[model samples]
Target chain A: MTIAEQVGAPRIVPGRGIPYPCGDPNLPPAAERQWRRQLVQRALDAVAVAVEHPTIFEVDDVNA
Target chain B: MRIVHYVNQFYAGLGGEDSAGIGARVLKGTVGPGRLLAQLLGAEHDIVATLVCGDDHAASHTTAAPELLKMAQAAGADLLVAGPAFGSGRYGLACARLAAVAQAAGLPALAAMHPDNPGISEAGDAPVIAAGATAREMRPSVQRLAAAVTKLAAGEALTAADGRVIQAARVGQLVEQRAAARAVELVLRRLGGDREATEVPVGGFGVVDPAAPVDKAASVTVALVTEGAVVPAGNPDRLESARASRWLRYPVEGADTLASGAWESVDGGFATTAANADPNRLLPLDAARALEREGAIGRLHGEFLTTVGNGTPVATARRFGVEWAAQLRKAGVQAAILTAT
Candidate 1:
């Protein structure tokens, strides 16, 4: 959750990566891309929504 | 694109914290991450020079930002790249602040730092990429920061992950959720059976500049407000013992002080027995009235406001303040003495 108070923009949940890893290393190459894609899409949605209260947006993983 | 680069003494191979007291110096070519940044930027951009400075000098002394801007101006730089400062507090603060300094000079600029870095607060829309907590992750961080620079060169919007610094907001929370459930969906879903949403995103908290010091404290009506949850016996307003989102006002008109038997503290976070025995301990209605009697102040607002400050989320707390401030303004409260436990 990057509560973008710094930029004064919408908050962002970049799924799970450290300073720069965008996707899970445990996942296969293709699966990692999928997870990463989902995170990006959710981040877009998180910004699109109008939220007054600080919120936690959940990003989906690949379908089980 | 001509680019002006800023790197710390350690990254420029000068020394670590031991050399942090040194002054700023400019070198003609790329050093350290500048080399990698140049590669990421390719032949299209020129690394005019890398300005190296000690983090201590940059953060403690005021000359750092101006020196960087002067170098940029001298080099005719079209862009500025400042730090992927990782978790180094002073270095991070310097990075963000210097980028702001450059931006104010009319140069396009961006910086990178560990998300938790205090410098993020200084990264006011100048664009900041969230970097890893340690330089061990520099390879990826450099890549991300380069990507942000690329966006700047192309004049594109930067995303939070790309280059947005979350100023004044606590970054991320972990909650339970499948990777498959990216958006709002209660239906069961899973991505490789993963679970946990660790980041809780917070919205911008409105900042209220301090009301100019009351022209005269003695001439203005002052109200006493407490967030330690002091209230009348049995908690008539039913304020939550924890994470309270509401405030209550109790009138003190006519009475010199709040009576202990009639009013008591009910904060679950604290043993109220002490305050219950002396309600004035937290509210100080008696002392406040004493001042009123002495004309030490014009008048005390009839009612004081209170809520439990413990564990309240920033959003809830913000709403409580915005709503209450409006009420206080309407009631003509020129100033307030706020006490929080």
Candidate 2:
């Protein structure tokens, strides 16, 4: 996350980790896919919004 | 002090660009600009031998440096000097390489070139005296080289104040306080309204103005790019698992999702077991494709670009970004989703 900020990524959405950025292996296949869908959707929404600087778009903020 | 000088064929009075294919050879002494340089260094410095190499030959061959250094050592050289190559790219690079080899061989060395020369990056801590853009500034360039040599021969440290190009490397210095104590002091200073109390200064990466927001996500072609090292099964293009010098693109025109057996993550920075089991976790191709179908996006780009980011230099990453962005723009890609690991 700090790496993204340091590199000045304009619209940042936090990822799970290095191994599974979109999906969680701990979840069931269906749940994993659903979680991935949400994460990816958040990324899509991030691109649609304009940002003045490197801004983090939290999943909670997106959900709200 | 006995000095051995390195110069390109042109500077050695051995013809012009047509002679660039000629291999390395040694001239007896004081070829072309070496005479001016010798005069600038005064009577104490003797340019014992002049090593002349064709730019084309020097740029392509790595074996030349050690051989040339041997010749210099045989000539009883106390110092190795390479061009004030000025704006010439190949010559500057050759000079920089020679300086590096000389330093490793325990022969003190100095190179002169324009600071913006691409060779500056290859210089590796060797002193590079700032020169003008072309030979038109030869006098000043030689003067700077002479001044640097005088100090070096006397066992003096060359600093930026001496007109030596400071390399983009960190110099270690012993500090009186421990790291934890320093950190606490810095924080306390900052809390006490010292806004600029930073021990480490962040730089190098330049600010990029954010691109305008996608006016309509449902009508733009979005491409997926990744540093997750997702490549075709068997790693067909052989995208490096670490410090990737290049990026590869795989066709996904007819594919709905990245199947487990069809693609895998080979990034060396992290364990790939999870990503290999489900490549889409790193690329999110399945999710992206679904989003396209659901009208969240207009369409998916036919191919996705991938490269390993593990331990890759920032400059290389920036170059890849620029090239990819140009290619994407040419393909009418309005935006890109770059996934990183």
Best by DockQ: 2
Task: Please give each candidate's TM-score.
Answer: 0.44, 0.54
What are the DockQ scores of the candidates, in order? 0.01, 0.57
List candidate 2 stretches off by more than 4 Å.
Answer: A60-64, B1-203
Q: Tell me the spans in candidate 1 whose CA falls farther than 4 Å from its real position.
A: A1-64, B161-163, B166-341
TM-score of chain B of each: 0.51, 0.56
Per residue, candidate 1 scores C-alpha lDDT tens digits across A19-63 of 112345466656654554454344334434556544456776655
- Global lDDT scores for all candidate models: 0.70, 0.84
Fraction of native contacts under 8 Å reproduced by each candidate: 0.00, 0.74
- Compared with the true structure, model 2 gives a TM-score of 0.54
